[model samples]
Target: MPHAYQPPQRRSRLTRRGRLLLLFTALLGLGLGATVLLPLLSPGEAPEKPRQLLIPEGWRAAQVYAAIDKE
Candidate 1:
């Protein structure tokens, strides 16, 4: 009697439910990272410093030029 050949069983890398679960998990992680972690990791702007300038009373233009030249 002659025996019939049998084909090998096929295996799936990912099932439909597994694919959906993986996609959902990836989206959830991204959403949490953007909403919760991004702000915590970002740097805030530094506070501005006050500026001051001084001018002498009755100062002549020539005097200012001489003072700047000395510096």
Candidate 2:
């Protein structure tokens, strides 16, 4: 003997408005995630700006590097 087959039941799903709300939430999450992660992933070099520093005439390049590294 064989048993009769039955159709599968439909799943409860979000309505049209609920679908749109979910999409909006997903996009917001993606944008915020990118904003926080992008910086740490690629820290672009600091812009090179021309600035003058006044120092004793005798201060050599090595001394300047040492002084800056110490601070």
Each prediction's whole-model lDDT (CA):
0.83, 0.88
Model 1 misplacement above 4 A: 1-12, 41-71
User: Per-residue lDDT of 8-60 in model 1, one digit per residue for the tens?
Assistant: 87986898999999999999999988999877888977767865434588898
For all predicted structures, in order, the TM-scores are 0.39, 0.48
The backbone clash count of each candidate, in order, is 0, 0
Candidate 1 residue 24 C-alpha distance from true site, Å:
0.3
Evaluated against the true structure, the overall lDDT of model 2 is 0.88
lDDT per residue (tens digit) for residues 1-71 in model 2: 49788899899999999999999999999999999999989969998888665667899999988877765
TM-score of 2: 0.48
Candidate 2 runs further than 4 Å off: 1-9, 46-71
Q: Which structure among the candidates has the greatest lDDT? A: 2
